[model samples]
Target: MSLNFDPQWLSRYPAQEPVGGAVSSCVFCGIACGDVEAHVLAETADTLCFLDHLPATYGHVLVVPKQHFQDLLDIPEESFQHVMATAKQVANALRDSCGASGINLVHATGQAAHQTVFHFHVHVVPRYDGDSIVVFPRLADPTRKHEVAQRLRTALNAPQPPKTEAESSQA
Candidate 1:
């Protein structure tokens, strides 16, 4: 058993700390802490909006909490609400500035949900008419929609799963 936290020493002993699916050396966390550089757009007490390093469109933005929330599941409701509001602002700025055809606020929660970045962030992707990117292709109606909706509605109406101590305190 040994301890190694040297950033430069990572080349010799590559390792990482995983905290509830969150990487301690997360790039977004560095950016949040001002340890990394980013083209900042807007910042609030709880959230930060910035241009995506790899833009899907011209004004693609990423809205994230200043705190290191691993994903949507880890963020508090108030922080999540603020993040959504910041995303909306970014979307409106994109639309008003460039007359965007549409905008997609994408939040990939878990690894299974295609979340590459462990940090909780909403991608404000702007859409333009005739843009090469196919935001959403037309798809045939799903089978058993009504049946699934009824099942989901019934599930939604059922009592929620018991909360943990942390969640109960959050409430």
Candidate 2:
């Protein structure tokens, strides 16, 4: 291998899928299971949408596919479209609920992608002038990182899918 680094060289690599491990366990999975308090915005056969437990903004929400895939590559194309379509629905709902100017839909696939939770989820943050939350993320303590990672890993190990057909309808 050449010692020289090149950005273009990295592009040659094919994308990778999420590997299930400890990080798959997250409290968010509990929220997704209705074990915790979350303002559910939408749910489809392939996806479910809810407010972010830790709000990025007043109306921050999340859209997750029903299947427990950690990252994008693990998601089937149909599930991907369903998740994104649900995200769009949540964006509209957030606009109506919060009366915001706009919304931002986001996702992080890998650790490098800032995917704190291993389960695949899309963020829908409502944007408005003078909002309390900032766009930037705060840094975390490195010492506690491993412990926190372990906790999340345990939580997401096994996830229950949406319980009923009614639960899979519009928000």
TM-score of each: 0.79, 0.60
After superposing candidate 2, which stretches have Cα over 4 Å from the reference? 1-26, 132-171
- Candidate 1 accuracy as TM-score: 0.79
| lDDT by residue for model 1 (1-171), tens | 344333231244222333575555787888887888999988999899888887778898999998888777778899899999999988899999978989988787765555666788999999988887754453436887998899999999999889999889978
The 10 consecutive residues of candidate 2 with the worst lDDT sum are: 1-10
Model 1 misplaced stretches (Cα beyond 4 Å) = 1-23, 137-141, 162-165
Q: Would you list the C-alpha lDDT of every candidate in the order shown?
A: 0.79, 0.71
Rate residue 155 of model 1 by lDDT: 95
Q: Tell me, by TM-score, which candidate is best.
A: 1
* Ten-residue stretch with the least lDDT total in model 1: 6-15
